[model samples]
Target: MSTVAIGLLWIFLYDPSNGPINQFTSALGLGQFNWLGDPNLAMVAILIVVIWQFSPFYMILFKAAMVGIPEELYESAKIDGANGWKQFLYITFPSLMPTIVTSSVLAIVGSLKAFDIFFIMTGGGPGNATEILGTYMYSQGFVNFNMGYASTIAAVMFLIAFVCVLIIQFIDYKRKKRGILS
Candidate 1:
């Protein structure tokens, strides 16, 4: 589905009054909740939406990486009596370091620039409770017509993402240099 469609679907699913979530809660006797209205719930609601939307991509990445891992290694570990946890710790985790770093970097950068879902769902509403950098920048530039400040916010966002990428790269490099990841 298009981003707009997905956004609208989430809005429908999370509607404070008639959303499926409230219906389910009412059935369970947990009472209805303002999923997208209450300040505390709003952030949690956005978090759930963001995770729901992006987790599949990251899961696919990790799955592909896992598939590419040589089966022989696990077999040998098993023969050596290494438990599943040990095999995962010493073999699977190291083997997937690159993919993990890549996915983490992508998630960080994408989140920094995320705007559409938040905008469509809340428009930074309920008193700015869900205002991320991307939405804040949009509000400043388009809603408030403060282009200069918006540009500054955009630049800062870029810098923060860049720094995160650099940090991930540095850690990956260190791991590889130390032979923790081959």
Candidate 2:
């Protein structure tokens, strides 16, 4: 689903008086608790939204990586009396490391640009609890009409994202050079 749709859906889901979440909690005698309005929970609510939006993509990526793995390794592991857990710890985990690193890079870079859902859900509010670089940059540039500061924020975001990707790539390269790329 689109970010706008997800944001609007979560906003409704977070409605304290009538949202399904609160209603469910109330039914269980947990009482109503505000999801988005509470600063402490607002970031958690956004995190749930982010996870819901991106988890399926990660699943598919990992599935594809698993499918590409040679069957011989697992067969040999089985013959060697490696239990499921050991097979996973030894073969599967190592095999998935590259994909995991790639996913980490993608997640980090994408999170640096997260703005739409945060804007729609909380606007970095309940007292700046959910404020992120993207939201702050937008606020400075548009809401406060401070383009220079916004530009600086954008540059910093770019630099941070670039550095994150570079560092992850360097680590991955080192692992590969050490023959750990499985």
Candidate 3:
């Protein structure tokens, strides 16, 4: 689903009185909780939506990585009397490094650029509790009509995202080199 749709759905689901989330919580004796309306929970609410939206894609990526792991490695670990945890630590975990690195880079950058859902859901409201750089930039540019500040914000966002990706890649490269050298 589109970000807008996801945001809208969550907005409904987070409705203070009638939303299913509130209903579920009430059923569990937690009472109806205002999600987006509550400053404390607004960011958490957005995070929950983000995770709900992104989990399936990551799951598929990890599943493919898991499937690609060589069966011989597992057999070798078994012959060496490695238990399940050891096998995972030595064999499966290392094999999934590339996928994990890629996922980390994507997540770091994507999160920095996340705007639509935040805009749709809260517009950085409830006293800016859910405000991120993207939302702030948008507000400065479009809502407040501050072009220069908005442009600067955009540039900074780009640099931050670029640096984050580069850092993650560099770390992954160094780790890979160390593993290969060993």
Candidate 4:
């Protein structure tokens, strides 16, 4: 939704043939891609796009966690002379830590494995500006016909993902041991 708004704003604020984005790209000393015909804003642009795409899930998780917090906690914080910001800092945020961490791990995994969006938007072009692990794997196996190398990349991706999940679980376990797994 925010991405759509940004796109609409871009259309309103920039020219088609030579958009404000192009001017910004030119200032950065990068050339345009023949395929996209858009300037070399692919890196920043794709990062923005990925963040936008994943934000909704984060927002929903945040809202659900906030809603799950008991009202008594807020009342107690207020009774203890905690201001709004202080209550959020000492109460709400601590209570939400596990959920936040989980969401963060998911976001990282999703970003690492993302391919469809980058493929459709940039095709890993403009000099590999938006080449992610998944896109790189596809290029290696299909485009370059190096199945061995592609499988290697796949194994690496799996290892990274496994490590991430292990880290999340370890942190969760420690939190539980410390009685912090609220």
Candidate 5:
């Protein structure tokens, strides 16, 4: 689904008065609370929305990585009496390290560029409570018509994300080198 659609759906669900969330709370005698309007809660609300939207994608990545691991490793571990947790720790985790690093990089970069949900949901409202770099750049470029500043913000975001990827690669390289040395 498009970000606009997801954002609208989340807005409807999180609406303070007649939203299903508030309604459910009221039904449970917890009373109504503004989810997106409150300054303190708006960021939390956005966090929840982002997590809900992306968790399944990450889960699929993890599942694929786990499935790619050869069955022989797990079979040997099981034969050695390694329980589920030990098997996971000794076999699954090491095998998934590359996937985990790749996923982390993707997630970090995607998050740095995230704008749609915040734009549609809050528009950086409630006094910029949930303003992120992407939304801030949009606001600066389009809303304020400060193209120069917006470009600078975009550059900075790119730099930050690039640095993160480079750092991950460096760490992975060092780990590989250490493994070879050992």
Candidate 6:
């Protein structure tokens, strides 16, 4: 339900031909904006929208993880006279670390490859304010008819994503090896 609400909000904010960002900026008393104007505001707004659109899945995952935690941990903590914060810090956090890392990685990949929402929202316009690598690749390939460059961009994006995942996995592996992971 929450996810559906966020998705609807994102759709409402997304305007291919006309966005409300300019009106918002002017209304906020951000000074007379001419050259360095609405695009900046729109970019920020779009980012917020994107994060909001993506957040519900993370929220669900976190909620489930939290609920899945055995009550015994808290009970034991209570017996030990550990406060809620202390118990959370010493127990819940360590348990949730892996879930958080996994969810973050998924979010990063989703962001890097995101296009549909952005395309419908901004069309990578206002001087390319919302031009992500994914959209940029599409523009270069289809819009500009430069398949070679677009392919190169695709390769680079893939490399960057692969490297990030590799680094995260490596760190996780090391932590597990060192008996630091739960």
Between the candidate structures 2 and 4, which one is better when assessed by lDDT?
Answer: 2
Q: By TM-score, is 3 or 4 better? A: 3
lDDT, candidate 4, 20-119, per-residue tens: 6556656788643332434465566666656766788889999999999999999998998999999888789888997888896897688778777667
lDDT of each: 0.90, 0.94, 0.92, 0.75, 0.92, 0.75
Q: What's the CA error at residue 113 for candidate 2, in Å?
A: 0.4
- Quote the positional error of residue 140 for candidate 3 in Å: 0.6
Inter-residue clash pairs, candidate 2: none
Better of 4 and 5 by TM-score: 5
**Candidate 5, residue 21: CA error in Å?**
0.7
Candidate 6, residues 7-122, lDDT tens digits: the string is: 45654544333435435655788533332136866677667776766677799999899998899989999999999899989789888988988986897777778877666566
- Residues 98-182 of candidate 1 have per-residue lDDT tens digits of 8989998999999899999899889887799998998999989998999999999999999999999999999889888998756
Candidate 2 residue lDDT tens string, 54-170: 999999999999998899999999999999999898899999998899899999999999999999999999899999999999999999999999999999999999999999999
Instruction: Write down the TM-score for model 5.
Output: 0.95
Residues 16-80 of candidate 5 have per-residue lDDT tens digits of: 98899999999999999899999999999989999999999999999998899999989999999
**What ranges in model 2 sit over 4 Å off?**
none
Name the better of 3 and 4 by lDDT: 3
Misplaced by over 4 Å in model 1 are none
Model 4 spans > 4 angstroms off: 1-40, 179-182
> Best lDDT goes to which candidate?
2
Clash pairs, candidate 1, are none
- Comparing 1 and 6 by lDDT, which wins? 1
